[model samples]
Target: MTAFQPDLSSALAGSACLGAWAHDPASDRIALSPVLARLLAVPAEAATGTSLTLALAAVEAEDAVRVAGVLRAAGEDGRPFEAEFRTRPGPDGARWLRLMGRCGRDPATGAVTTQGLAFDLTEGRRPVGSDAQQAQRQVNRLADHAAAMKGLVAGLRNPPLARLVDEVAVEVGHELARHLRGGGRQVH
Candidate 1:
C-alpha cells in the first residue's frame, strides 16, 4: 500500500486541498467530495451515478488512456494506482492533478470499488512567471555547473576543492528546497 503523506493529512481530513472519491462499478455510483466534482468540472448533481463519463471527459486527451488503464487494472486486479496528469479545469490552460487510490472487491458479489484522493498540483506545475521559478532555474544552472566541476575535481583529485564544492552543492540543494516550499526570497 502507498503510504499517505503526513503533510496532506490535515487537508485530506478537511477535504480542503484534497478530493476523495469512492467509485462503485456495480451500481455505477460514485461518491465524491464537492472538491472532486469541481476539479472534474462536473456539476454537483452529476457527481454521482453514471455521470462519470462527463467527468472523465474533462481529463486531457493524452492522459485519458493512462487514467483508464490505471482504473481498469485497479478494478480488475485489486491494485493501487497513482497518476499525474494535466487537466483543462477551465478556459485557462491545463493544470496538473495527482490521483492516488486503491481498489477492492466485495467478497459476496465480486463488485469492484475504487477509492482515492486527488491533489491539485497546478501551482507547482505552473510556476512559470513566479520568483520561485526563477530561483529554480538558477538552481538548475548551478546543478549543471556543479556536475561539470565534479568531473574536473575527480580527475584532478583536489581534495580541498572537492570538499568545498560538496558543501556548496548541499547549500544549493537547501536553497532549491526552500524555493519550492514557497520561500519566495532568494537564499543569500
Candidate 2:
C-alpha cells in the first residue's frame, strides 16, 4: 500500500468526508480508502487484505447484529441496501454512519461487489433516533391521559360535588402532563 490519498477522485465527488471500497467481485478482495478505514477505525494497511466479514466483526455487537440481515441479502441475492448504524470510533466517543449502496455485478468480472459511501454523522443523527423515542413516549402518555380522563368523567357524574371537583382536578393534571409530553400542544 503506497502513500496514496485513497484515489477517490471520481467516486467521492460532492461527498462529505467519506470512504469508498471497490472490490474484485470474484475474489471478494476489497480496495478501501482511508476515509472509510478511519470511519471503521481499521488500519489502512490491514484493511486492504481483510475480508468484509472480518471487518464487520469489529463493529459493535449490537449494530453488527442489526446489519447482518442486510449483509446476507446483499451477498446471496445482490440485493440493494441502505442502513444507518452506530459504531464506537475508539476511546474518544461514538459516531453514527449512514451507508447507502448495493451489491451488483462488477463491470470487470460480472461478479457482485458491495460498494457504497460511508460518512460519519457526529451531530446529524442524534435528533432522528431521539425524535422517534420521544414520539413513542408521547403516544404512551396520551394513552394514559385518555384512561385517566375516562375515570374522571365517570367520577364527576356520580353526585358528590366534593368528589367531582377532586376528580376534575386529577383529570386536568393528567391532561397537562400529556400536553407537555406532546410538545406542549394544547389539546382540547
Candidate 3:
C-alpha cells in the first residue's frame, strides 16, 4: 500500500509538534511518519509496518482504551474522530497529543483506511514529578511491556501464535491497570 503523507506544513504552519499517520484495516497495519513515530516512542524502523495495537501501546494506560475505541468507531462508520490523550511517561515525562482523522476508501483497492495527524499539546509545559506522576510511571512500565510484546507479535508468521501473544499482552495490560486502580489514589 502507498504511504499516506498528508500536507502538514500549511496545517501546522511550521509547528514542530505535528505528525501524520494512516491506518489500513484490511491489513491491520498502521503507517506513522518519522516525526510521529518518535513522538509515540516507536522505533523508526518499525513505524511504517506497525499495527494499531502497537501504536496505541505508547499511549498512557488511562487513555489507551478510549483512544482505541474512538479510532475503531471511526474506522467502522467512516466518520471523523478527534481525541486528546497523554503519552506514557518518558524522558520528557508524559505529554499530551491530539489525534484527528477520518475514514475513506482507497480508490484503487476500495480498502477502508483512516488518515490523520497528531499534534503535540505539551510544547510549552515543563515536565515535573509528583506522586501522581510516579504512579503513572509505574503504569507506563506496563505499557512498555505491552509494546514489546506487540513487536514480537508483529514478527510471528503463524496466525495462532500472533493472536496468542496479542491476547497475553492485552490481558497483562488490563491486569496491571486493575492493580493500579486498586490503589487508593487516582490521577486525572
Candidate 4:
C-alpha cells in the first residue's frame, strides 16, 4: 500500500489556533490558555479569577450583547455555540475573535461550566491552498528577515522600524501555528 500523506497546504489553510478555556460560575474560577490571555491583553495569571469578564471586555460594545446572549443560551440549554465578533480596541484596530464552546454540568459538584476554544479571526482569512503554502514559505523566509531586520535596526537606530518587523514576525508565527493546530471540526 502507498504511504498516506496529508496535504500540508490545505490542512494549514483550513486550520485554526484553538485556545481552550473552562469557566466555573459557582466558584467564579476560570482556566485559560496563554494564547487566550495574550489575545485579550490580560496577564496570564490574572485570567484565572475573572476570565469571562476579560474575554467579554475584548468584544466590541455593539456585539457584546449578542455574543453574551449566545453564550448565555448555551449555558442554560447545554448546547454548543460558535460566534465571530469584533473586539473593541481602536478605530483602526481589527480585533476579531471567534469563540466555539459548550456548557456542561459536573456530576459530582453539580456546577455548570462552559468550555471551548477561541480563535483569533482578526485577519478575516480563509486562506486559499496556494496562499497557505506561500504563507508557510514566507514564515521560513522571515527567519532570515528577522535577523536582518534586527541588524539593520541596530545600525540605523530606528526603533519604529524594529517594532514593525517584530510585529510582523510575531503575526506570521502565530498564524502559522494556529493554522496547524485548528484541524478538527467545530465542537459539538
| Full-model lDDT for every candidate | 0.72, 0.62, 0.77, 0.68
Q: How many residue pairs clash in each candidate?
A: 0, 0, 0, 1
**Best first by lDDT, ranked:** 3, 1, 4, 2
* Weakest lDDT window of 10 consecutive positions for candidate 3: 1-10
Model 3, residue pairs in steric clash: none
Model 4's TM-score against the true structure: 0.53
lDDT score of residue 15 within candidate 2 = 49
Candidate 2 residues lying further than 4 Å off, grouped into runs, are 1-17, 22-30, 89-92, 126-182, 186-188
lDDT of 3 by residue, 20-126 (tens): 88888777678988877877787899898798788888898869899877777878999887888999887767888888999998899888998898777776344
Work out candidate 3's RMSD over C-alphas. 13.6
> Candidate 1 regions off by >4 Å?
1-16, 26-29, 89-93, 107-110, 128-188
Q: Please provide, for model 2 over 1-188, each residue's C-alpha lDDT reduced to its tens digit, 9 standing for 90 to 100.
A: 23564555643553454766654445545556776666666677866756655555557778867665565566677766666677765754677776766788758977677777676666543444566465655555556656655665665566575466556656666665655576565554
TM-score attained by model 2: 0.54
Q: How many times do residue backbones clash in model 1?
A: 0
Winning model by TM-score: 3
Report model 3's TM-score to 2 decimal places. Answer: 0.58
Clashing pairs in model 1, backbone N/Cα/C closer than 3 A = none
* lDDT tens digits by residue: candidate 1, 54-173: 667778887877876677677777777788787765764566887789898779987789888887776654457767666677777677777766775877778999999888877777
In what order do the candidates fall by TM-score, top score first? Answer: 3, 1, 2, 4
